[model samples]
Target: MPQSELGPLKSRTPSSERAVPAQELRCGRRLSGWVLAALCAALLGCQPARADVCPSKDIRNNVTNLQTLENCTVIEGHLKILLMFKTKPEHFRGLTFPKLRVVTDYLLLFRVYGLESLSDLFPNLTVIRGNNLFFNYALVVFEMLQLREVGLHSLMNITRGAVRIEKNPELCYLSTLDWSKILDSVEDNYIVANKNDRECGDVCPGAPRGETLCPTTTLNGHFSERCWTQKFCQKKRCDATTQFGEVRVFAPFALV
Candidate 1:
């Protein structure tokens, strides 16, 4: 070898001398894995720690059976109450979900015997974020023979579905509820059908007969008052005294 070409003999550094520590390299890999997992969870809206209380199951309208719902605060899927032919109405009178705040899917109440009202059942339920499997309604009440009032008094929002109230023969307060006051917006996505027609006449005098009348525009602009009070004014012109007078007159002329 020529002396000029081989003159520079710099000290050789081993590859191991520049290598990262094993423990630190392993920790870096673990940190990267954790970051990727966190990003995936956020994008998928994963709720791994919170399991569903009632995962797409039906709850028969039996008092003893429904006690399963007493401690459930959130239902990740549907909550269906149906087929209470053997149960009495009073048995459901005590059924309440004081802690329930949200139903991630739908809440269905159908063919419940003797269920007079829902006002007391879900008093604290504030939201129904529907990820429903069938229809788009977050809440469905159908064919409840004795259901008189929908008692969702504290319900403030339904994030992604409609509302359906139908075939509840004795339900009377549907026409009076100002749904816009409770929900963010009804958006013309409701179905109120096959309820008691005579009560409908008494509650919503001018509303069309035997059809869905949800988001009833003829509501007397009140939250819980009777709609018949303003029915005459809605149908025909009347003086202020006649409209807002404390004295009320029925068709058969009963004064109160």
Candidate 2:
């Protein structure tokens, strides 16, 4: 997890790493991955002394233990893919880890039934690091009944906690995601009862001549014709002439 380049006070340790500031304090609001490493460790005041050891058992084997986490890039603990028995859903086509980008803690998928798309299974998962949370949810996709598009599009981040994607009945873009751009604060986040957006007739590559980059959600605030498909878009959607690997080299906006 030391590919570095994480600006503004970098903080992502797990290879015999140490330091803690009461589990990175966590106040709230739109920052970005590791929240700039816990705000670069609280503006150099540095904190966090412990926390990271809670996966005693929970990977319910299949797909060869998820292909042995394909040389994990950082998964210190808690990545439960619970209670399996004759796993289906194409057994996760081309199941990939391709170098996971950090789980640090919390990322469960209960009743996982033939997954649909995590883009390419954790496609360079951005970050889950709730440090450790299940009851408080760091990212729980419950009852994945033939899940549709969670397509993690290089997941933005979930630093502290909150997010309980419940009863995935053919999950869709979850309203083109706008969890305050990726939670900093906002509890009770139970992205409730999936499967609705007009029965998932989602269509996007460009929302009808609008040159798609997907990210438009407004209910009481108007505009909601819903059509975010390009694998359900994410952060800016990258730039430059897209023609690369790992889904257009992490630019927070690169999936064209």
Candidate 3:
């Protein structure tokens, strides 16, 4: 037969050669699948359970009953934090707990929504961390009547929870580098209001009255006119012709 027409004989060196590549591929696929499965399992394991986030108005008394101690952080007994609604329970005012006595060790924080100010609500609670806290636009004092504790570092408000800081634009009195200074400034402003205006409409009978009716000045009244004229108008305005022009010209500027 011609050499060109003859084909090479099938190599029969070993049967193992034919099966080895397929076996190696099968082993590689099995190993890849196992690695993939392990990676998937690991990813799922690290995810937080739905139970971790408490919803609004759903009060869970004795939270220790719900999850294992390991799953929940134990601050004192079994409760780590008691989540209260800022508004659902009643718009950030605070929950009315007549029988409430928070254990200091077990409860980490009390998160409430719509907090206009954080002064009195958590008087005993020195530290807090949450989302959705409204700035205290109407707060003057931080009255922690039963609290002598220390350390208030974790206090904060966030986006979606009872502790969220939102909707409080008029809370200028509560924030300052020196809160005492801020309090002093607020007190000064309050005194100014009380001095010029009759708040409860209770005029002080013992108040010092000059010649003119000074106590009659309300917050929106001409207070300086009564005060200045009452004290020194007679001594200074004996020359009425000389004073009228001066008084009239400077009257607009005095209004300011």
- Tens digits of per-residue lDDT, candidate 3, 11-120, equal 11111111111112211232332333344457654322122222222223343322332222111221333333323313424432211112111122233223333333
Q: Which stretches of candidate 2 lie over 4 Å from their true place?
A: 1-56, 61-76, 86-104, 108-111, 114-157, 160-169, 184-196, 201-256
The 0-to-1 C-alpha lDDT of every candidate, in the order given, reads 0.52, 0.57, 0.21
TM-score of each: 0.55, 0.28, 0.18
Best by lDDT: 2
Please provide, for model 2 over 30-129, each residue's C-alpha lDDT reduced to its tens digit, 9 standing for 90 to 100: 3343444354466765543222222323577475677666665556677777656678877888778756655656787776667777788777677665
Q: List the residue pairs that clash in candidate 1.
A: 119-151
Native-to-model Cα distance after best TM-score fit, residue 41 in candidate 1, in Å: 29
Ranking by lDDT: 2, 1, 3
Ranking by TM-score: 1, 2, 3
User: Mind sharing the TM-score for model 1?
Assistant: 0.55
Off by over 4 Å in 1: 1-54, 194-256
Least accurate 10 contiguous residues by lDDT in model 3: 247-256
- Expressed as tens digits, the lDDT of each residue in 200-246 for candidate 1 is 54444344455333333545444333232223211111111112212
Instruction: Give the range where candidate 1 is weakest over 10 consecutive residues by summed lDDT.
Output: 233-242
